[model samples]
Target: MGEQRKVLVTGASRGIGRAICNRLHADGYAVVGIARTRPADLPEGMDFHCADLSSAEDLRGLLKKLAAQGPYHGLVNNVGLVQSDPLADVLLEDLHRAVALNLEAAILCAQALIGGMREAGFGRIVNISSRAALGKQSRTIYSATKAGVIGMTRTWALEFAAQGVTVNAVAPGPIATEFFWDANPDRDATTAKLLAAIPVGRIGEPDDVANAVAYLLDRRTGFVTGQTHFVCGGMTVGAA
Candidate 1:
């Protein structure tokens, strides 16, 4: 074998991000995971970097450090902010925060990393989106931010296609991660309603989304770009 390809994953301490880190590393990528908190049980074959991704200055500093260290050919923009507020009750501060982390941060990271990828003449960018991007109750800002991610994915894919880079989005639906449990602690009638709608009749796992991302990141899949893969247990298929 040769040297393992390097990948940078954001929000990678747990949940879907952590799963992506594991999956990519298993696929022979040198995985560097960035998150606010370092995982005590870090996965094998992965390195961890602790940073507040939502902070522009901190992200810039992290990028500078990574730049000085080496180039990263693969990037997973898995950092996001999910806020639950009705449209009428949405706060500007909440919207700003969501956009800053969910949308702006991804753009900034891409901007910072694309140079190294350009030099390498190969890259893969996977943005973690959500089914909520399609629309959801009490997800005004969250929906907007995720939708923005999709838009950026498409534009970046187009811009980088000629340079051997692919950009895509993975929109997960009703995954059983910590974020899901925390958001639906009661698991009441609303939970039942959600389950009833999923055609698969179960919550999705983090690995489900990770698998889709792994596909997009594969070296053989360079021709596939600007696509939004929905790993939503058929939830995006409509009454299935």
Candidate 2:
């Protein structure tokens, strides 16, 4: 078994983030979870540090302190927020919040952690993107910010690749998570369409995405940097 590797997962209170933590922990990684709220119950030996990713100062402070205390072997950027308003109707505050939480904070965290990772000569940075970032509609604000994340993934993949650090992105289409309902309280009808569109004919679960993340972090997948893997039941292929 590999020695317990150090990993830091953002937005790990619940849903996909929580699942990712569980997966890595089982694989013998020392996992630290960060979120606005702490989960009621997590695996034993798990460490959690709560912080608001939307705040610039909070983002910088938390990441710097964490890096000082750790030569983290892995970083998972899973924290994100969405705005349900149309381009013609989005508010400035919501737009700022979307970009801040989804893209800006992620970039800052990497800036603070990448140096340590490089010095350690090994690191795994997984940017949790969305198929919505690839090509979608009516999500102008959320899409723009998410698309930036994909770009960041590609750029950093190259920068970290030769340094023994692997940077990749996993864009999940739609999984049944608390954030989904929070974004669309009346979006249940989209389920049938989603399942029909997915070749698998089933909506995804947290574990499904978590499994994909685990694979990308595999030692053998080191050569797989700068690639965005879609864990959306082949949504990247087509809806048909």
Candidate 3:
């Protein structure tokens, strides 16, 4: 594959982002991976770009470089941050940072490469959100940011529909990744409660979410934009 078939994925060093990169690469697309730290075990054929997405200036500069590369075939906004803080104790800085990294970065990154997609008349954009966006006790800011991502996904889908560009969102729930373990430690009652609430009776793997993203990015799914694909293992079926 060449630049015409290139796909950019942020937060590609770990978790769902890494899985998406691998899946797209396996599907014969040139993968461009972005993250603050480069992973030692990134898959072959995947190019890495290191940058802190939380910094607006840094993210803009990175996008500029990516734009210079020309016409990405796909974009996966899988970079995000989650913080568990009660409403009263939540810091303004935390909220601002969450909005910047989780929401703003995705929008800016999309704007950076959408022009080429428009000219080429084909593109796939996937924004990774969280089931917590529905509502969660301690994830107020995080949920808000993810919810904002959903809104942008819908709007972009409409804006680019006629241009042959599709925009959609994937919301994962209770995925068993390093980020989950680091945020909610094992042996905690809250963790147990979350597990019990999952109708699957098991935690989801990063590949579960990755597979859904791959489907949406497929050329066959060009008619499936402006929708939120919940990779939540049936957790969103009822009041869990």
Which candidate's TM-score is highest?
3
Local distance difference test, each candidate: 0.88, 0.84, 0.90
Against the true structure, what is each candidate's TM-score? 0.95, 0.93, 0.96
User: Which residues of candidate 3, in runs, are more than 4 Å off?
Assistant: none
Identify the leading candidate in terms of lDDT: 3
lDDT tens digits, residues 107-128, model 2? 8889988998899788889999
Per-residue error for 75 in candidate 1, Å, reads 0.3
Residue clash pairs of candidate 3: none
lDDT of 1 by residue, 1-240 (tens): 123278889999999999999898888888889999998989765788899898999999888877566667689999888798778999999898888899878988898889878777888999999999999899989889999999999999999998889999999999989888776664578877887888988889999999999999888998899999999989888622
User: On TM-score, who's better, 1 or 2?
Assistant: 1
Better of 1 and 2 by lDDT: 1
Error of 2 at 48 (Å): 0.3
Model 1 ranges with Cα > 4 A deviation: 1-4, 238-240
Q: Model 1 compared with the native: what TM-score?
A: 0.95
Give candidate 1's whole-model lDDT: 0.88
Task: State the weakest 10-residue window (summed lDDT) of model 2.
Answer: 184-193
Ranking by lDDT: 3, 1, 2
Q: What is the C-alpha RMSD of each candidate to the true structure, in Å?
A: 1.7, 2.1, 1.3
Report the error of model 2 at residue 127, Å: 0.2
Looking at model 2, the pairs that clash are none
